[model samples]
Target: MASPPCSAASNFDCGLEIKTRSVEQTLIPLVSQITTLINHKDRLKKTEKTLRAIQKVGQAVGVAVGRFVAVGEAIALENEELREEMGHACFEARRSGTAIAQLTDVCGVEQSAGVDRCTVFSDKMAMVKAARMLLSSVTKVLVLADRIVIKQITSSRSRVLVTLEQLERVSTFQEFVQIFSQFGNEMVEFAHLTGDRQNDLKDEKKRARMAAARAVLEKCTMMLLTASKTCLRHPDCESARINKDGVFQRMRLALEQVIEIVTDARPGAEPKALPISIYNGIQDFKARVEALRDCVYCVPCESLAVQLEALVEQTEDFTDSAYTSHEQRENVLQLCHATRQDTHNLVATFSQDQQSIKAREVSEAMELAILKTSHSVSELRRELHNVAVGRASELLKIHSDHAILQALKTAGEDGNLEKVADLARTLTEQREQLVETCRLLCHISGTEPLEITCIHAEETFHVIGPQIISAAQTFALHPNSKIARENLDVFCESWESQLGDMAVLLKEINDVFEGRRGDKRAYLSLPRPGKHSANLKTVKATKLDAEELSTIAKLGLELRLVTSDVDSELERWEDQNHDLARQCGSMARVVCSMALFTRGEGVLKTTLDLFHQAELLSEQGLQLCSLLQDFSTQLLDEERVLMVSEMEKLAVSCQQLQACAKTPVQGKSATFQKVDSCIQHTKGIMTVVASLLPLWHKLIRQCQSEHSSQASPQHWPDTQLSPPLKEDTLNGKGSNGFGVKSLEQHMASLTFLESK
Candidate 1:
């Protein structure tokens, strides 16, 4: 091979063959590997996108599963239908979880491939299958959850509607309260379910739906409570007319039920020793008192007012347990005292109507009830204050100990001897202050001090101090080494754990103390023990004075005397007026007959004689009317004026009759008949005057009665008077003298003559 010498064409041909072999052996494979790597990179990107999508789907499924589980737990144990549905939802959620797990395993297996050349096509297929399965399961669970939620919503809505309808139809208080309580319970359940579901739901829309439902329930509860309060405060008086006893009984029952419902509906994880205002305890107490006050005036049945008062007292006693503040309790007690006094005054007023003994009995019962309620409130306030003071002191001691330990830890870590010493002194001072505070609280609350164990805090700080000294020495020996830092970090971590424990203990104490305090202010801020004396003095100052009582008695006596005098005068005037009117009528008739029979000068002389007699009678009537006016002016001035005017009209009519009769007949038959008609009309006027006399007498008597009954003289004239004379009297048969048979007969004679 070494000896081969070739020409230029042969050499070129050999070089070309070698180059072709090299291209076939190396470059083609290298290019093919680069193409494979690019394809694999693209497939990986696609797989990663598919994996992210699957993860999102899986997470959504997980959240759906959690929601379904919560829904299952929230469904009432007694509701078989909802429970079954919840079970189905939970099962679907579990199946979804299994599918998601299988999908995750597939993704892990696909990602386990070593080379980028192995595409994740199998993983993508698995991801799609898993996603489909998860979607199916999640969809089923969501549907079940929706169905359960819808069912619960429908049930709650129906219950609320029924309760509201029943509330509207309720005629009695008891029925209304029962329905209200039922409604409140349903709403509470609905809110609780919604809240639980909201907490579990990850979907914003579903959570929003739950929040909206809860808000609706809360609004409905508030409206119902407001309605109950309104009814209790100002009950319909017209409803009482239908069945008063039943209405009162029902009202009492309803109020009690409403209070119970409000108490139960209050938002607290646990029942408080003292009730919070959120329960509407104060409002309910006020409502109960107002109800008692209102019912006292128009109680439907005998003893109903008494029963209501007793119930109010009992309610006050119950509400007293809810009062933790001394000021509020004292205020309520004062209000109760005021109500009792007001009721007494009301009873006294009612007693003036000849019901003294009954009023006295009712007042005594109310007084007893109020006294008992006030006593209960006082006792409850005292107990609550004592409890609060004791609890606050204990909690403060715990927190102080925790703070002291924390200070000690920080000072020890800094390796500052002066600061450590100062912290030690502070810890000692804190201990002493805590002890003194506890003693003071115990003395104020009238209770024994509770024993507290703080061994852990002491031990933790005791070890930390020595550890800090060791760490400082180690740092001095090895400044650049991590050993000192590591040691200090370990100590710090251990101290942190101790501090965490102390914090937890303090937090527990705080929670307990705050819960005991409820809605009250700090116990130490309550009024001093002697504040009750001032309140008592204020209550006593409201009593009426002896001078006022004497004035009232004197006024009553004067009224009675005036009434007697007026009554006697009215009777005497009625008789005198009747006699005078009858005499005038007789005289007029005689004159009319004389004029009709006689003519010319003889008739004229007879009319003059009649006029003289009429003058005397008219003078007597005028004197009687003047006397009536004088008496009526004292009580009924307006009536007196009307009577006087009528008397003047009668006198005028009499004068006209006299003038007509005095005219000479002189062979004129028409003139004589006209004179007769004038006399008849005059008799009719006299008859009207006579009829009005009794009415005037009645009005005078009424004024006397009114003056006796009322206290103020200004109110006396406001008394209602008898109605005016009827149309028959003014313009009908009475005015025409047809009411009087004698007058009618006389007028008939005149009519006969006119006809002839």
Candidate 2:
């Protein structure tokens, strides 16, 4: 009853019509089983997510249909070996681009345009010989299907051998001709499941077929060292003779296949090996034989520096021809022995001053032969006073003939015999011209008149010539009484032997005028003393060591070593004007101290000691002006050594005055006599030309007063000066002075060394 009341509305409906057929059969089967369990749990949650997406699309359709049937049988056997290696890599890329365009048309470069390229290398070698005839049937079906598909590629066929190596790296050539037209239906189902796995080899697969035959013999030994550098950069290559016979016979069969693959990979323990390109081509032929032995040692070092520069120019011309023939045979034997010892002391002092001029020319020829015998005894006493004053007064006519015989006995007894024969024919023609003038005054006073002759002259007969001059004056007063008793015993024995030879030639001319008055007791009886001292002496008395003499007892020590080499070449030509005779003995001691300042009062102390010895000879002529300016600048730098020291002092003063006039004064050598009076006054022959002509004109006037006091810039300004220091002020009056063309070039080189 409670249950019947429980349906309040049911009861009210069942009560309303059995609750409308139990709510229509339990709500239409519970709303069709709750809409068929929500459409069967949304169709089992869309068939368990479409049966886990159709079981992951049947495991990705069995890995994409077993990787699209093993990449459609490895792209149908690599598209039949990539259509036979893409028609042999397009016929080896058109036969290596037509053999590199016929090696750039035989290397003259620029070719490849019209595409001839050896007709594209003969159409790429006929397409690489039809791709090597289909690469031997596609490498025997890819070596039994790539060795059973790379050993059953696990990860679901390694994506079909990685999609057949990405379809052979981008399949082409008409997709390898539609994959080699499906290579007989995928290479007979991949050669029936890759049976016999291509008969294994494996030593790492025979070291990868000997690393592809040592990488094709190291690419044919790098194309035979690039075809010997393309036959050395292609000398107009005929493809360089086909790259030297096909790349040097394919690099000598690729270096004999890299020496048979390094002798079959050197028993491959497998640590590492390779690298043998035929032992690196024998170390590149030993570095090209050491660069041809350094180019043959640089050709003998350039021919030994050109034969050592022609043997140093023939040893400097044979040492200048042996120093110019030993300085011209020692300057021609020192000017022929100091001009033969200064012309033998100027020919023995000019032959001792020509013996007082030959004794005054024999006392003027004996006073002109005693005035010609006193003019023949005054012309025989004026012809005996004209025969005793007028023909002996008519032959002493007995007082004029007794007044003419008492006037002719008073003229009656007749004195008219023809007028006394004309006065006895004028007294016998004046007594025969006075007996021929007394026979010419006894024949000109050679006094031979021992006879007075008046031959029978009838008119002159009584004139017996005065009894023949009284018997020739009684034989001329008897003068020949034995020549007056031998002329008083030879004039008392030749007047004491001519006054002892004129007192020994007046004591040798008073010891040469009292040794020129400096009389050291007139050179102490000088017969020879310190010979005219040009100094140089050496006398260790006595020596004879020509090997202790024996060469004929060392003929005077080989003639005193050959006259000491001719007196050392004659003292080198008497020291060639010995510095111009010591600058003319310091200008004759400044002209004898300016003639001792003109004597007496010692004029200003001998002119300040001769201007202090002429400023010490102008400082020794400016130190001999650097030795006469180094001997006049070595005679202007060797004007043949100052003309061989002035022809060796004029050939040794002419061989010492021709050997002192054929050698004389050896005079028992007491030695001295100023070397025989300087070899008899040869003052070194003209005292070196009178002391070099006034010491070269006072060294060119002291080098023109030192080049007119040297203030260069070609100094000019002359305004005439030089007449004896024209107002002398060189270093004063506004300093810079002395120009005038350097004192007129030192007075024109001191008038050219005073006219040389």
Candidate 3:
């Protein structure tokens, strides 16, 4: 019960845990193959089949090990700090793979059936040694690659700090503008880097802590921009200075927290990881239970029983929760009972194996019990997945319509305190539902990252509910105050943003369950545009009204759905690693993040970041449109015209957005008009994307079908074509594609507005 004697097999004793799921799971098949190679004679009689079996598994192992080392070597080239160690590990892996190949040669034995039973079995020792070496090397490589990831994050954080200091010390508006632009670029880089790291981390609490730190930096960034400008405008004002100082302080603290998490720099800073769920407990229990075959005398069967009981107790989380459906509760109970029975049978077989005649039949019986227990555990996990995914889906739909927020807004504006109070109660009830759902989700999310997202959602709802109430009180008290309404709108958007985040997280969880997850780049790719931060002293962005925010939120939701649709089509491509898929997937992620950013509580922090994202999106869109234009006659001319026209609209809108972001306007009316124009432009861009996404997907599928099966694509049946021929430069692979001037037109995003 104390511990399983520092198990080299369990502890993984490599000084690192593989936090990435792909790296961890990659070892499973190799392990199984090795086990088969060493124990083949036990299962198969000596013959030509046995020789072929050895050849088959040996070649597979060598090739797998070789490819695994290649990945490690590539990582080494990227991270100089880990290069030597990673290179050494990769070398060892390749050497061991060669050793495995030689050990299982069996070529001379193939020609003769009776090459001495001793010769056939003699090299098993060397084979085991080579397999161990190969496995160890592969693990070392994975761990080293993981270290490189951490190093990249630490290096990114250092860059942000350097810019942070410059931004804090700048005295002139021009100096601040230049430094903040660099700072924005750095922060975006840091955001993208840390976001990937955050998702890759296996520790749920660490992910949550990282999320919290990043959230602080994101909001403080927007605050920092305004606070610094205010201080520069009123050099003698203490409040402005204090506000600027506070933003700087929070930014630094968030920066520190992020690094501390990745590096565990501070003593005692490592938080306890999330409590091990029933799924993990069952895995450990089964491992210990299975160990009885070899180490029956050394193992304590009592501990196995205790661990099973603990797993069963953990299931009480699902069974006892009021939110759980009766059927799910019953199913969980049944699985728990089945697992207990299977475990009991396995332990009984273990006892019989120890006391009886050490017969092959008894050994076989114990194996059967182990397999059944494992199956029971698998069933339990599936049921848990269903429960979690189902509950999450229901909660998402229930919380989808933000009618309560709209009602609260209207009531506040109307000075109806009773209506506002009633809506607040309804919101409170909704918050409780979300919080409980989060707790249930954490138990069955199946991965640390998702569990963290669930916890974040819960906390968002918990923190923002009271803020919404407080803001509503202020709005009702001063119905005429624009600031009060804005405050309330901010809280409402925060709630909506959490909903949007939860939707994405749900899809991710489902994707993991279905085994459709791609590489790390696809995990969080932005490839965002970096722009000069402008001094906007004379051009305060006119705040979006309720109608505008509503439109933005609706657009956000639509973009998210379309991006999901694009992801599905991308998955259907024959070549998973195709450049076109990667490019489109990157654009999809940017759009997805843009969707969340538009929803208001996302990582973009300010309108400036939003404008920057929009320009980058149009740039990607034009590139995509060009690619489409170059495609064969699969696309009809009119459809081509539509795609090209929409892209042009997106481009022009980005152009207008860039101008609005840069130029200073004199009147509030002028500022409002300019801001409205920007919004309308963004709407046009969103509309283009929403309509074009399906066409792009259809075209890709058509191209794919043509390549493999030579099937004609589904074409548009309409003959009434729109007029064409404004430009012929929309070719996908043309050197003379949409020129650099258009790129320049959008490069002045968030400009340093200097009055001439």
Candidate 4:
């Protein structure tokens, strides 16, 4: 019978049942999503909520799911205890029958059938066994019922696969109505019983529960999409409904995904080949150089300065030691490595230019273009001086002897021997003084003591001694004594030759210090032939593009800024002024924050814009990182997820309890206990989720205020704000009124399901 043509009363029954089922299935997920969205409508929503609630209630609002789990655990423990009790009773009953013979033997007494079969004994044993069996059966039934209920809760939402045409294609609303009732009944039945048998659920029930969960998740998603569309069309009612239904949860998850993408950053935009370690190394090197420079700059002397000139020369040679700063060295290495890798990748990935020049050729040429300003050669000169200075004292003594000998020879040639004695006395005294001075300075560079070699001392002494002797002789002899002066002339010539050789060596060293002899090309030119291959047109055809040129210029500028000696007071003054400007910027931010809170969000946004400009100017990467941390604290919170999960759990528990009420074992204590456990669990989770709301709300407030305080670019101060001081009292003990005793009591009362 095609049921009477849609009678009003019949239609009401049918429509109401079908719609009720559909709404139950759809609403849970919809609510979950809305809850999440509400959490993140702005970052501060949860934080503000948490703060206000904390201030009002003086209690920690924790996630509902945590409470739910705690309750579940308690129930599981109680059920296990029941099972053990039942097992023990069964064991006793079984032992009473089978082990009677053993007992008789042990007691040495005859057994009587009367004792075993008597009404009183048999009744007592039967009652105990029945009670145990009843408990076991009830526990199993309740567990199964709970599972069924959970499944239904997870699958309550309707998924209408039918299109408009398909719906119209239905033979009659009767068939549609019957199908809807069947599905709805199944969902409702499962929802009611699952609460009863939550713990002792079987494999099939577990699978069914999982399937239902998945289905519910899908349906929820669809409902959310529908609701969102509806909100877009006629937002007022839909928006309110969405909030009530908890559709905000899914929105928050979506937003989080987007945030992750934004924060990841692009690969190519990362800074060039300057390793962080290298930067630190350069800083250390800079410090060393600055200390050395300060030492030199403080010294004031003219004659002592002249005496200490060698030490100054050595210091100049060591100045290049700063170039060995880890940063500069690593930077050079990194540049080379990156260039090589790029070239290698290109060569391996693509065919080399056959018509054009080879990459190797270009690389060689590039290598030749790199400059090296090493001070190794000057360092070698200093080393050589240390090597020879020790012999200075011995040479001084030998030279004095040579002077006396020369004077004697001169006196003899002039026929004035008396003057030789006087010269010898003066020469000996001068030699002693020279020897002592040389001794003091001998080990100045910490080299080994230098002994005068017989060959060198003799050669010098012989040459100079004869010259002195000849001079003395010439003075004593007649002005016309040509034959007597011939020997003197020969000696003088020898002495001049020796002095000229010594002078030539000394001049060579002096000229090197004065920048006269070494090849300038060697200092400026590259060691390798192709280090600058990237710049060579003949080797690899590439024009100097703006980006490439800019990169090269930036690199050059950074190197110069770091490496150049900025020892002047003016440079220090500039640094101090820059610091003051930075401090002012921080103060400005605080002011802007106050403006944001008092004036309007627009003011805050203006302030932020100005802050960004100032931040860029300051080049304070660490400070920027700190700001990012603050921003992230405001933006990202996991409370939304916790809230959604809690709501779902609570809905499931309610459904399971209702399902259990309809089951055959409706009056079972185990079933009631299961329901109680689920309810407690749900309550716990709710508490936990609620706890985080205030923190989220506070964060959102901060974020909004920051945005409103943005400053104008033109009038923006060349400064930035310091980070806000943290409030230690905000989350202290009194801030949350859950004392130790209260928490322990709460924990003791709840049944929590331990996750596998």
What is candidate 4's local distance difference test score?
0.31
- Comparing candidate 2 with candidate 3, which one achieves the higher TM-score? 3
In angstroms, give how far residue 712 of model 4 lies from its true place.
4.7
Better of 1 and 4 by TM-score: 1
Of candidate 2, the 10-residue stretch with the lowest lDDT total is: 747-756
TM-score of each: 0.20, 0.14, 0.47, 0.16
- Candidate 1 regions with alpha-carbon error over 4 angstroms: 1-42, 45-123, 174-179, 190-756
Q: Between which residue pairs do clashes occur in model 3?
A: 534-751, 534-752, 535-752, 626-731, 626-732, 627-732
* Candidate 3 off by > 4 Å: 1-216, 219-254, 267-269, 290-298, 359-368, 514-756
- Kindly list the per-residue Cα lDDT of model 1 for residues 425-480, writing each as its tens digit: 65555444333333222222221111111222333345344443343333333344
What TM-score number comes out for model 2? 0.14
lDDT minimum window of 10 residues, candidate 3: 725-734
Worst 10 residues of 4 by lDDT: 561-570
- Model 1 — TM-score against the truth? 0.20
- In candidate 1, list every pair of residues with a backbone clash: 173-250, 173-251, 174-250
Model 3 has a clash total of 6
- Using TM-score as the measure, the top candidate is 3
Cα distance off (Å), candidate 3, residue 217: 3.9
